[model samples]
Target: KLSPPLPLPPLPPKPIPKPRPLPPPSFLSAVHQGNNDWWRYLMAVGLIGSVFFVLTAALSTLALGLGWISLAPDGSVTIRDPLVSYLLSHLPFGFLGLGLWWAVVGLHHRPCRTLIRACGSLRWGRMAQGAAIWLALIISPLAVALLLNPGSLMPQVDWNQWLRLLGLAMVLTPMQIAVEELFFRGYLLQASGLLTQKPWILCLVNGILFMIVHLDNPETGYGLGWLALYYAGFGIFTTWITLRDQGLELALGMHAANNGFVILLVSYGDAVVETPALFSATSFDAAGVVLAFAVRALGFCALFFGIPGLRRDSVPPLQPQGSASEKPPGS
Candidate 1:
């Protein structure tokens, strides 16, 4: 009776469930969140990036002129000495350029990681996931295609030179790919994004720049425009994922894995890179190769972009640490 009577007194209402906290905003979101004048971003990211790259190019040219590093008249680095070749491939992406990007980001009181990833730091986990996906999706497919067309592969290698090349690829290729990513996806994306939040615009601009940079690459038979298209497409695919995921970890991982594999397993023609990969593409059906590449890339994008809660799209405490008004004075 007492319990029944007590039940008459309604139980206290249950508390409302609090929503899970959202992580901090990524640079894509940050740029949008900030009330920045489009130009401020351009200067912070684009201007700085351009200056650094130009400076580096001049330095690289100086190195070539001085014979510190050998280069073809067309301005491509010649791989005569294993060590010099490694340096040439890696120099552009090295501290000279990337460090300047980092420094510029810091100049505006933003962490370099913000330019590089939404997490404001390098997320190794995301990178690994991306690398794994690239290997499974793209690298594996390329291997299968090569197997199906064995004649496309280049002449057999001397294990000694091949082994040395393998080491070079493992060590230097990552640096080269990383440099490219930082320039294209990191500073370039961030700076350009300030102009417009539209993903397609960003994709085209970044993609074209990427393709242009490879103009001197000797990869032939695919036709220059077609090759450039492929490069642009690759850039678009990567930028798409980077923007969607709100970080560069996946892009870096994917590129590193893709280029690493290509450099170690196969390369051919006036391909910008001349690695001692196990095989070379002596005969590539450009259309088939490009189509196959696109298919694999699409698959990669779906997996990397489709996952939920794999990681925060941005770091936490989402208040606008990036407000343009908040941009450091004269930054």
Candidate 2:
């Protein structure tokens, strides 16, 4: 061997691999498992509308004939028993739920659970956490309001009526909330995602649609603009959370709690879903209501995102379930 072998040249530096891009959030990407033709969505919409209209008209006629509901000269509706009215108002949602299932599962051939969560199941624990957070945010302000103006607390129902209302609310309120969550945040939001990947864009469009849906609500009397903004804001908030969590459980829980509180604890004049609430406000405070909403929205986001273990989507990348009729694109 040669006395002096040249030292081996220094090895070249290894190339750093570029990080793989992350997949879209499961709540949006869930749509990939199904056929996404525009006409299919239109069919789903038509089905939902037809189902809702038929159910509402039939129920209204029956309620009027039964003397359970009355119409005033100005077209204001009065329900004889708030509990029965709640049932009437919420019953359509049960049918609508079926229509939605048919739309997502039957028409689109997508797994139904994908409409609710990426994991193909409902996370009851996540829902309960969301409910607790919403309750705390709402109750805090109500407590403060009562302390400031005790006179505003006018009792609206006896304990017996409240007990009955509670029972009905425990059943009907969640049903109503689930349908809404499934439609707007689940179906509509995913549809919108097909066109854009921007979170803000998705949230903005969802908000506008939600506002339009609520345009006919009795709360519009507070000021059409204010109510519109309020409804839109709620949509944005819920949609944002849905995107963040990659599921509808949090939204469902929060919505259920909000409606339950209004229906069972406190209500005001011109409420859409009349209930035998424990207390009624003599005057509507539109500004205060909006402010409280803003506060709650901020608190909810901060707490949910900042706290460990509060996020549901932190586990793993979304995996399409075998139940999907079509294999997801690029899988």
Candidate 3:
């Protein structure tokens, strides 16, 4: 009773609540809306698996009809037709992967500008930066190898065929890379992220799925342990980048450029997806393959992520997954 409570200071004015900006739509956010469990994984697998099977078969047949493939009377199928084989391996994933995501996630029910990024759109500059960095890393190693072992690489140009392959590669290679990025790095990563918030766990899960799915490739089919490491590294690095960047722009650019260069400049000996490259290597260079891992990891992490402006300060904040505003009203 200090002087009758000292006459309380004038009450502070109430803070006007700031208007909240709407949340950006993203697949990583959307996956949490519905129940995600092993069953959903299996169902997505089955649905996408069926689409892959059917679409590949239909396209393969069309390829055969177009004389891009050969079916022997003995029931042997030939993958020697580079253009057709590449297409058969990948084309279906483009359209069908989108369909699978659309149906499984029910995008129509809850609209997201993109399942690719939380920004509601891709930042093209990031993609370009990623592509440029990876392209340099990939080609530099190969170029050094080519210089050292000139005899190891040979030009195999059937102008007509090379031109044809170039046309098709320009069209399909990006599609193929996009397919892998969408499903593995984008879809699978987002799906798995819902199960756990730890970035490393999500990376591991997505990496393992990627490595397993690619088991059918010639590199894995023949049990090339080193190549397995390469793919594993690829999955992990890309997934990690996506998590850090909070988007697929960088990852997609890296994958596309990596595959694009591999298809055009030189190809490994035991390649499953052969293309009419300008120069084909006689054997797989273990040194080059090993160097690729170091370059991609170090270069991507240090340079791309380290640059002043390139740092991920631009990404928007995300709302809590189970927040009242996150889910639509009703049961």
Q: What lDDT does each candidate get?
A: 0.63, 0.78, 0.67
Q: What is the C-alpha RMSD of each candidate to the true structure, in Å?
A: 8.5, 9.0, 9.2
Report the lDDT of model 2 for residue 176: 85
Question: What is the per-residue lDDT of model 2 for residues 234-268, given as tens digits with 9 covering 90 to 100?
Answer: 89999888877788989988888888778887777
The residue-by-residue lDDT of candidate 1 on 113-210, one tens digit each, is 56576556677988898889777775565556567765655665667877887766677667776767776787678767666767788888988888
How many residue pairs clash per model? 7, 0, 0
Candidate 3, superposed: residue stretches over 4 Å from native: 1-27, 33-42, 65-67, 104-108, 111-113, 221-223, 286-288, 315-331
TM-score leaderboard ranking:
2, 3, 1
What would the per-residue lDDT of candidate 3 be over residues 132-157, giving only the tens digit for each residue? 98778766765676677677778887
Residue pairs with colliding backbones in model 1 are 24-315, 24-316, 154-280, 218-270, 218-271, 219-270, 219-271
| Candidate 1 ranges with C-alpha deviation above 4 Å | 1-16, 31-79, 95-99, 305-331
Best by TM-score: 2
Ranking 1 against 2 by lDDT, winner: 2
The TM-scores, one per candidate, come to: 0.74, 0.84, 0.79
Candidate 2 deviant stretches above 4 angstroms = 1-25, 71-78, 308-331
